[model samples]
Target: MGRKSSLTDDQWVEIERRHLVDGISINALAQEFGVNESSLRRRIKPNKAEPKKAAKSLQALAEMKVEVDAKAKHFAEQLGALPFAKQQIVSDLARKLTNTSEHMASAAEISAASSHRLSRMANQQLELVDEVDPMKTRAQLESFAALQKLANISGEMPGRLAALSRGQPPEAPPSQEEVDQELALLLGSGGG
Candidate 1:
């Protein structure tokens, strides 16, 4: 290599998330993050083949769901024959599996809804041809606020899912003081 890159793994991940998920442009991300435009473009190149892959993945998921349902039914039938402790264990596992499946379905719905909303927002913005400052419109501002809220929920979802899988309550949000301290550290470190 000719030289070392200053960006960290987390920064690269954030860059990818902003570009891929938030639909931020490579040019804007490079200027905001002080990175090479070409490098950013290469790193976050869109996967045109993903729709096909996603279709296959969905098929696989459907097959897996059928298998899981069969197994769960078998287990439920056998649950009555097991000892009390084992029955309790099986019951708990079944409950957890059901919860996880529900969560997965909910997440998929949210993701689809978010994609639809984003597309609608993009179309609305494009239709504001006569407006000098489309972004300043009240509807646009409300849309941005709603998107920000969705982003925050999306960011916390993985942690919530993990907690649910572990049969634990989701962790509480950080206190304002804790958030301030973290912000100070980030600022001190130039946001890594």
Candidate 2:
């Protein structure tokens, strides 16, 4: 017969609960409960069927929630302390960014759905290539190319929107009149 366990039934239950349900490490539990690590492992029989729980306990989640709430409150207080004009600018910039993000998300969803549908259609076309007319395949390829361009535009839209929100226009080649004026100013200054 095996040696009698020094721990009570209630203590064993608590240890198993902490290890399996609470996701606490056996070593840590042993250290906390002042029991031998190997002995604790032998006593606790983990169920093979049920998946292990996440390491974070309910108490930990509660503490994290409190910390996040405090931080958000502090941030709001800081934002409220800002001058009205600065606050307005901040709010406008936030609104612009949010709109840009929504547009990008919508574009992404459309592109993804279109791409998936095209892929399925393409697979079917490949199987029917010998029987189907070549014109239909060409049209499908063109549609795919258009979708790719749309995806590229969607990827670049955020940066373009951000630049516009910051009051910077997209760079363009200088006009001939502007270049002439610059040249004249440089020449006039050099002659003096």
Candidate 3:
């Protein structure tokens, strides 16, 4: 003879309700009911109503899609009903704001770079001034004059000073050929 069920018919109905309507998993229900999982599954046989449930779910999804489409169309119609001049003004404002934002960002980057370069140059100049004695101001002025002359001749004084401040050798001056070309241009322009 087969083993008799420990649960009453009412308890079995409750278990089925939990497994289907409450969405309790079969394994969990089996553990709660103190029954073998296989026996619980066999007794429940949930597959019988799957096709009906699936059909209902698909119908609900289709209804929801129809609602969404209707709402979207209504929104589009409302947007289209706006005055053409108002829409044009809004579009133009949006474009101008976007362009202004880009320009501001570019200007900010340039300003930041220029500020950094100026700050570094100022700091270097301060360090140079600190190194010279105040009593030797006249000699210092003469040295500055010579440095300026060298800078003017090579067109690289600022670059060399920057490099020296960073403990680096100044970049090599332009080649003689390049210098000759520049000189030729100046002479040709009658302003040598």
Q: Pick the candidate with the highest lDDT.
A: 1
Residue 40 alpha-carbon offset, candidate 2, angstroms: 27
In model 1, state the lDDT of residue 164: 76
Q: Tell me the TM-score of each prediction against the true structure.
A: 0.28, 0.39, 0.30
Error of 3 at 16 (Å): 33
Best candidate per TM-score, number? 2
How would you encode candidate 1's per-residue C-alpha lDDT over 1-192 as one tens digit per residue?
Answer: 645767898998898767655778879989999989888765555345562453356468878999999998987778878899998887799899999899886886676567566656655644543366544564654444445445444546656767778999998877756654654453343333
lDDT of each: 0.67, 0.64, 0.65
Q: The CA-based lDDT of model 2 is what? A: 0.64
Candidate 1 lDDT score at position 151: 47
In the range 9-63, model 2's lDDT, one tens digit per residue, is 9998898777766789999998998888888865564333432322235447768
Q: Any idea what lDDT model 1 has?
A: 0.67
| Candidate 2 residue-pair clash tally | 0
Judge candidate 1 at residue 46 and give its lDDT: 38
Candidate 2 weakest ten by summed lDDT: 46-55
Ranking by lDDT: 1, 3, 2
Predicted candidate 3 versus true structure: per-residue lDDT over 71-122, tens digit per residue: 9899678768889987777679879999987786566555555555555544
Q: List per-candidate RMSD values in Å.
A: 22.8, 15.0, 22.7
Cα deviation of 98, candidate 3, in Å: 0.6
